[model samples]
Target: MSHVANIMLSVDPDDRPTVESLSRWLQTSAPLRGHGPGATGRVGPLGGTTGEDTRRGDGGFPERDVYAGALDHADLDELIAHVERLAWRQPEFVHLFVTDQEQSSFRVWRFHGPKLRQISPEGREEEVRPAGGPPDIHTRFALAGDVELLRDMVVAAVNWGPGPAAPREAVLSDPRNAHYVDGWPRPGDLGLVALATREVDRWEPAPVGAAWLRHFTEDDPGYGFVGDDVPELSIGVDAAQRGRGTGTALIRRLLRTAREAGIERVSLSVGRDNPAVGLYTREGFRLHGRDEGEDSLTMVVHLR
Candidate 1:
């Protein structure tokens, strides 16, 4: 699971001082902790195939210095966000390039405060969703009256992302899925809803995601049922609400709640192709088994 990733960053010449500081910190930070001999660093005008054409088309931005290094995927993600934050704080724009060990997939990002976005190879721009949850996001216990909300979230969870979602009725009508939300908030059912505010002064926040637990008997085990005693997790964040760490926050908090409730373990199922598997893995969920007759995996996390 610890794959290496190469990161390249281009920042305005005026920000060289900041880049230098960041370089010094990177050499000794938690990011490079377990790597054998640490990493190498070099500051120069942006080179490489990906940067050459783009830098040429950048007009009069001048030849900004670039910083490049490689690190473990987990630490790479953290380092990328840290670099993005530094870019956001800079007086001008910054460009970040990330690629896997084989250099097969390249992602480009531009950081400019409230205008952050990722640039595709085709020159298409899309909003960049950071990993950590923002300050405006709030979490609250899911109430019984939130059935409709949970239903919608269930659909989002099933689809995982932008793929076509089954009609709400059809999705919930299935006995398996229905058990997740039907008779919401039954005794021993625990859950939380995450709400986010678009504006700082906004008094009310819109619900963006939810996570809940349901118990099952051995005779009728859930898709990810590990034992009759372990609660199966059902979680989903609105499509528009993902990538901001809302799902992560919800899962982490819900797991803590489970531990406090005397539960020793939690279980869940995710599709083999679902990107959320990475998130779940990072949250300490380990593969238990393949769900029979399904293209999904059953995962479990020990709370004790």
Candidate 2:
């Protein structure tokens, strides 16, 4: 059997130090030629198809495609454009390994025809179709709890992994949310719960709803609500008040707010085994995903 190999180094325009470092590393690690500073060079065995044959000296390894050194913002844009051009010009190059020393993240993207596929470190695979649109990236939060919750979240996060899964426990222990002290909202309990972009225009709260807000304020005090582009809906009721329907009312208020703002969808995470899951489901929330450590279900509701 005969195989061909080609190695290419793509660098950002602003990172000269990285280019120099990589050049030295490649020189010592493999057979390569030194080009000028911040320049690409090629190295290879004379002529061999398979890597095994190249190792045996039947032929040398493949030549590398050298481009400019590390990239900057402008260079990154140029590089992406160049890659897209290559995809159109030469469709045979299927595998691309991208390393960003600037960002300290490495990604391997595979091209099949016009489609790109990203394989996550967790072994999840997501596809990017060229015709449909650009690639989509997401930020994932791990919900941790005790041993039992962790075990459940892990099973739900991925189907397989060793050890107990405790995403919430791990998160709470990380000293980030550790300083969180539970208490009642004093006189200045007037904190803002910024609505998400989708919720901003839809729902309106009645002045009388202030009394209803007491449930979320009194029980889930302390953590001021998040104010990001994607608003998180989190509600908690006092342990003693569990069966009294406080949670249900709080969610109803939130849904009302979302609807008033013209937001059609809302989502939240609750432990899978928790009774709250049933409440959400009964109220028209559908399970979207699961987190084991929190033993939670990521649920979403859509209002017409």
lDDT of 2: 0.36
Best by lDDT: 1
Report, for every candidate in turn, its global Cα lDDT versus the true structure: 0.70, 0.36
Per-model root-mean-square deviation over C-alphas = 17.8, 19.7
Residue 129 error, candidate 2, Å: 50
Candidate that scores best on TM-score: 1
Residue pairs in collision within model 1: none
Q: How accurate is candidate 1 locally (lDDT)?
A: 0.70
Question: In model 1, what is the error at residue 37, expressed in angstroms?
Answer: 43
